[model samples]
Target: VRLSVPTGFGHMVMSGWLIEFKRQYPDIALDLLFDNRVDDLLRDEVDVAVRVMSEPPQQMVATELAQVRYVTCASESYSREHPM
Candidate 1:
């Protein structure tokens, strides 16, 4: 299977479980593409694609995979110098 996934966070998340998947399904092979852009599935020869979006197109076959919480922080000095 050719799987398309985002570079950083998503790659980390997928690696967590894919280790077990490989152990269980040793006969199958997975090709993972780590990129931030959404690929044309058919054109890119990708069987599956994972992405993070607040909203997805209504026409697509989609499922709620997981919800991730993100945190933003800066050093005390940087935070003092720049305020949101």
Candidate 2:
């Protein structure tokens, strides 16, 4: 099965995870597309898509993965200078 993964900031940070997945599922084929836009699955560009912060369409099946808290982190000096 082909899987399409978005190569956003978070994905880039955890790029090494793919290596582990590949080792476990060596038989399955995968095609990775790194972009902010979603591709048409019917066109065969990708089979499974990993989407974050996106509402699911009617034709697609969505599975809830994990919940994460969004935190905006900045340097101490920067925050101190630009206090709210």
Candidate 3:
């Protein structure tokens, strides 16, 4: 199977998953493409792609795997001064 994943996520998360998957399914061949550029799914450049976006393309089938949450924090001095 050919998989296209972003650089950071592919390196930190998918690499480990791929290792375990390879261990379990030794017969299946896996090709990984780690790139920041957006790939053309309709053109069949990749069988599957891991993308981070607010919305998926209307023409393609998509599944929501996970959601990213962001946290904002301020230092004590800044918090005291800005009183939010």
Q: Could you say which candidate leads in lDDT?
A: 3
In model 1, where is the ten-residue run with the lowest total lDDT? Answer: 55-64
lDDT value, residue 12 of candidate 2: 60
Clash count, predicted structure 3 = 0
TM-score of 1: 0.86
Candidate number that wins on TM-score, 1 or 3: 1
lDDT of 1 by residue, 7-83 (tens): 88556788878788899999999998887775466788888778888776665577779997888989999988998
Kindly report which residue pairs in candidate 1 clash with one another: none
Counted clashes in each candidate structure:
0, 0, 0
Q: List the residue pairs that clash in candidate 2.
A: none
Worst 10 residues of 2 by lDDT: 5-14
Using TM-score as the measure, what is the rank order of every candidate, best first? 1, 3, 2
* Of 1 and 2, the candidate ranking higher by TM-score: 1
TM-scores, one per candidate = 0.86, 0.71, 0.73
RMSD of each: 1.5, 2.5, 3.0
lDDT of each: 0.80, 0.68, 0.82
Of models 2 and 3, which has the larger lDDT?
A: 3
lDDT of 2 by residue, 34-83 (tens): 65556577685676677776577777899966554678888999999999
